[model samples]
Target: MKNSQLYIITLVVLTFLGCKELEPRRPKEHSTTNFYKEVIEQNKKLNALETKRIKQTLDRDTLTTYQSSANGFWYTYINKDTVSSQTPIKGDIVTVKYNVTGLQGNQFYDYQTRDYTVDKEDFVPGLTEGIKLMKKGETITFVIPSYRAYGVTGDGSRIGINQTLRSTLTLIEIKKPNNETK
Candidate 1:
């Protein structure tokens, strides 16, 4: 009787221990919200630093007065078209002669003329908007931030990653589309 009672007590203890509730194991560090917040904060810091550097470079140039654009870039008219106020519209074929340089005055590309359909073809985002602000025979110098120009990945050959650029663009001509009347 004593042995049987001992065996029954052991079985009861084992059953009680095994009946304890089971729970799912949770990871200690699984939240992505904190990681994304850190990324955003780092990007803001980077943008602020880049803006400061660009402002310093602009301040050193006394020969030209830079005007900030609504699209997050800066520009100055090298040769303003005072007579004809017409600028290129969307779908207009525009011929432009341009040269690209770094903020430190390092030339990436020499002056070259090319034709593009405004807002239709793929081009530098800043230059595309700047070209809309130009008229035929007018030249303008644009100081573009990296985000507005090339972002992170650059043009592969000349412009490096996240490099600010200074480009002088001359509107050679603007050919309006055939469907539109002059």
Candidate 2:
């Protein structure tokens, strides 16, 4: 109908009339320099507080240190980059995916399979700490210190204390006896 056509034309004109490209904001309008500056200041303050807390909680003489706090929660590697954390409980058989490098930066193991759960008692304090913080497929880097590791006496094997071991671990699955699993 003629009336219907007129209405359609009017609708089309109204829709097109206000169509315009969006204007980009000026630098001043989009400037987030102030916001970033505030965030940086806050981060610095937090870092200072964390540093103090770590110093108070950790023993400078000991190689392996455990931290449980809101500021930071991790077992810092003392002598080497040996990963560790106490969150997963000590003496648990945890499935892990890991890549390990020696103090000389030699890649000893870089296994990436889903079947890598290690016994807590078998691993050093550092490794135990690391396993606690892992979830399925979560990768983490550990800069283990000497105390939580094979110390000055060494593990009588490949790893030693005062040695920084680098380990990137992924938790594939957690398993134990009496638990149904595939």
Lowest lDDT 10-mer window, candidate 2?
69-78
Residues 37-89 of candidate 2 have per-residue lDDT tens digits of 99889757755664554455354527554554332334332233234432333
Instruction: State each model's CA lDDT, in order.
Output: 0.92, 0.56
Shift in Å, residue 20, candidate 2 = 99
Clashes of 1: 0
lDDT of 1 by residue, 1-182 (tens): 99999999999999999999999998798669989999899988998999999999999999989999999999999899789988888899899999999988899999999998999999899999999999899999999999998889999898999999999999988888773432
Q: Against the hidden reference, what TM-scores do the models get?
A: 0.83, 0.44
Task: Please report, as a residue range, the 10-residue window in candidate 1 with the lowest summed lDDT.
Answer: 173-182
